[model samples]
Target chain A: MNTVSTSPYLAGLLQGQPPASPLTWLNELRANAVDRVGALTVPTTRDEDWRFTDISPLTKLSFQPAQGAAQLAPAAIEQWAIPEAAARLVFVDGIYAPGHSFNRAGLTVENLASGVSRHGAAVQAHLGRYADFERNVFTAVNTAFLHDGALILVPRDTALAAPVHLLFIATRKHAASYPRCLIVAESGSAVTVVEDYVALQSEAYFTSAVTELALTGNAEVHHVRVQREGAEAFHFANCAVSLAQASRYHSVSIALGGRISRHNLAALLAAEGAECRLDGLALIGGQQLADSHTLIDHASPRGSSRQLHKCIVDGAARAVFNGNIMVRPGAQRTDSSQSSRNLLLSARARVDTKPQLEIFADDVKCAHGATVGQLDVDEVFYLKSRGLSDTAARNLLTYAFGAEVIERIPVASLRNRLEQTVMERTHAAAPGAEGKP
Target chain B: MIYQDSKTLLSVRDLHASVSGTRILKGMNLTVKSGEVHAIMGPNGSGKSTFAKVLAGHPSYEVSGGEIEFEGRNLLELAAEARARAGVFLGFQYPIEIPGVANSQFLRLAYNTVQAGRGEDELDPLEFDDFVREKMKLLEMNPDFLDRSVNEGFSGGEKKRNEILQMALLEPRLAILDETDSGLDIDALRIVAGGVNQLANKDNAIVLVTHYQRLLNYIVPDYVHVMDAGRIVKTGGKELALELEERGYDWVGAEAKANARVNA
Candidate 1:
């Protein structure tokens, strides 16, 4: 390795890391991640992957790793309770809060620190394996700091009737938290997992999260990730998934908060007849920035993937979507399509959407499109002609645009909560520019 | 249905309008009394649609110089939604499709908004469902339409029928139908025309802007006006539709040009 010193930013973030794990393999994994973090530096706008997103604001601040979990009352988190969730794993400031969590599904759903000791072989086989921390500094940092997180392993031929919710809440200012999750679905098993990131404080904080999912043959997994951090926080996340033969993976991620947030998702279709569907939405306003980058790799024959991402931006906020689909050389009959649509609710609001498709297989079918525009005037007029005011019409249309993705969520209480949040945000963002004659 | 003391519902005086700096309605004038059905017929690009849009206060069209009075109020000063609340409706030739909004929700909101503007109590969803279902039967519409998105994936004729359904719900005093029968089959046309005929009464007036005399045959107009070059050039009774149907619009344009030359 090159003898380059760690940058002051990385050195500052490396402070207050948890002590080494008792498990040797886990300790070795953490040691390798620490070395990778030392080798890599924080990316800038000049980096091709971060050309549109400028994260210098994130580097200017110093953050210490959270030491202990904050004392939160049960009532503080009662509003986020999902009546349909079979289990909930609550993490406060990246530390597991066992007092506020429950699991009734009789599955292996527990904190990673304790889980690694019990499921050591299984955890070592998958943990830090799919998500490549060598090249990515944030993932490396998350891997280096990963000690306690949400761990779920579904047994073979088992199907859970209810979902598992992983709730990560930020409660401190100028503190950095690494939230990690690993889910493995065995052959012929199915599960629904929800990864939720929220905040109890409005002050500036940093959240770096990494999630890995592995689906074996004939396994199915539905993943829903929602990031609603504080207005002054910084959030970055990376999710890597691998699909085996005839396995299916479906994911819907919504970004509605954070001063500066970025989420990177990569799905690898490893074996034949694997399928993946990805849907995302970022509803932001008021100088906030949300960036989403997704990659769907069809590496085997008969693999299919479909993705749709939408953004509704208001005020001076900005949203970015970069989606890439790759059909490998031997991946015949690979079918994939992606659409990126954005709505700018104000003149100052901005959107950057890019859809890329690469197909080496001649018989593969791939289509992609990107659109950034204001609301359709004809649609607004149609609603207005029916006696709705201009403001109401624009708000309704904006809500409808985001609702297309929200409707895909399977959980009823979560879906209703998100619908209410979308409606409130759209209405609150609809006054100044939308009400103009 | 014309009464002895039928009041004037709409009066357009020298309505000059343009869209994107191109003059569309140049000094167009018309007056409609309550209970009268007027047909504004013209060839393509003859300002028939523009006239209907202008009356509805479409934002794209600029009224550089004009005045429109609806029920003795200055309709030009009101916004599109305000005009709708003020009992003015425009049936678009190509109704817009809103993909995510349910049809029942849209219709109920429209109905409640108009009802609230009239100082009447609004009905809840259950009450409105009963009220709207009864109205849908008049147009022979399927109840399943309530569950689908508004006008999304609807056939051309189905969109027109939806427009009439809204008209029936809102009960506007002055209704302008701009090519409402453009894309309908014979059976759809008969059903749609029957719905419009049923909604028309002595308290309201209907204005049909069409290019063909086919729609006029069903919902017969009391007066037929031929428009050309952005202004009406010929005005006659219902028989004029039949005459124009047989002897095409070329003679009318020629006659208008000759008349303009003689007057000049």
Candidate 2:
């Protein structure tokens, strides 16, 4: 119905798009998403929110939807799985893989493709409600191509003993993927979910992921996402959360890969005395560009939030952080704070950080700050003076910088794994590292 | 160089060094033989600290012309860490605080590193804990300090005591304590001096870089040398320290200027 021509990538995507499921309501959502995306123009640098990131290359590339799940060997797949996790949902190139996943009792994890046939009513009640697809282009794209994802449903008054992990692996070459998930936690329930994005092959690809969560009264949730994709990949992910009265939400996002990766995370405190904690760590090097934008909205009275985002840039890599806290009117006694700390390891490396607090409420307490600096020279020299090698000194300090955020995780085994991963990615110095060490 | 024992531990001959194109040490000469404790005293801006840093292979000091031999090896050829492993310790006047790194871990790494250099067996964490606790008793340090970050939020006196604790652990053969007594109270000064006195023996040498004569009162020096204008102008026994404290450095500077003019 439109006169304007679509980008080549969009044209290719539409041609290979899979047919919607037989459920009429699900089909209606997809049909509405297609028209919504067609009418709204793509975001550009001129937009205030998208000023720092350039998506022209993403629009120019001619990519089609992945044909099928990648058939990676079982041993390679097991090597990446967390053995201690209570349950797991494994997806390969936007399709659920049964052989690679393990589901335990006490929680309902339904695959979206098959979920529509069984729990279609519960799924339809929560899927498209939390994620604002109308204003977000990537969310609109994901909704239009919502073929398969995990549907997590936690019952009332139930507490998951251990974390449920979602392992989303990419193996499609030069293809675009849309991965979606919706989690609904009932009253007085508690759960923790971890999503890990990794690629089996080192080929160019596009991955746009969206996750929605709705926590009812007195529910608690912990969400952790780790992105370790390949060097030639482009990754964009958004997590939208809604917290009810007296509920708690805590989330941490760690970005260590992808040539160009962008993460947008936002939480809405909709009821009285709801609390949330948002923290993240980003480690990018070697011509990589990683950007993270976060928002914490306090809509009700006496809501509290804390946010901390840290970045370490090296080897001509660039990092950007934009954190906004909005304390709306009538949200009295709202306590919100945000801090962004960045360490640049090379002169060629760059970082731009902005922490904003927009308080319309009269009796709210809020604070925010951003700091960009290199490692301390005198500290490095002091380490070297104690018989540590130059590289060892730098590695120690760099690890300590990122460990501040990793230490906030409560799981010991998961923390140990992240520590090792951070060590491997942070061992090398950026060019000279330039200090006396 | 004159000494009762024949073996020399450190020999600096006509050392000239600069930092950032500004000359700091000009043709400095000193010699310390084994079984000796030497104290280098000077007024401010006499390059006493610079000489200590240069001897420890600090990267800031560019050696325009110098030759330093420690334990019969050319100290200039070794890197800073190599010099540390080679048993040359420089106790900093101002210790830097490294946040987020535990003090116990830093001490373990440092101890194991130097031990490995000497082909000695390295201690694991459990073994090193017992060893470090025994060493801490020598300085009267609490065991709870092991849990805190390295020098973070520590008082000035506590930092000085930590420097002494490192000296006890490393057991360096030639230690140049640069102004180790600058920021210490009387009680802290006593403990630090007592630890240094116990560590000194006939097999090694100690060089104390200080401004006041109070430190020499506790740890008596075999030789006290006066440095003026980046060069040693007077050398005598421990009695010189008392004389310098009593009559002040102006007399020495005047005498040195007169001698220099006569020689020229």
TM-score of chain A of each: 0.97, 0.94
Q: Which ten residues in a row have the lowest lDDT in candidate 2 chain A?
A: A428-437
lDDT of 2: 0.85
Error of 1 at A170 (Å): 1.1
Q: Candidate 1: which docking quality band?
A: acceptable
Q: What interface RMSD does every candidate have?
A: 4.4, 4.7
After superposition, the stretches of candidate 1 with alpha carbons farther than 4 Å from their true spots are A1-5, A432-437
Residues A312-386 of candidate 2 have per-residue lDDT tens digits of: 999989898999899999999999888899999888999989888888999999988889998786677777777
Please give the distance, in angstroms, between residue A359's alpha carbon in candidate 2 and its true position after superposition. 4.4
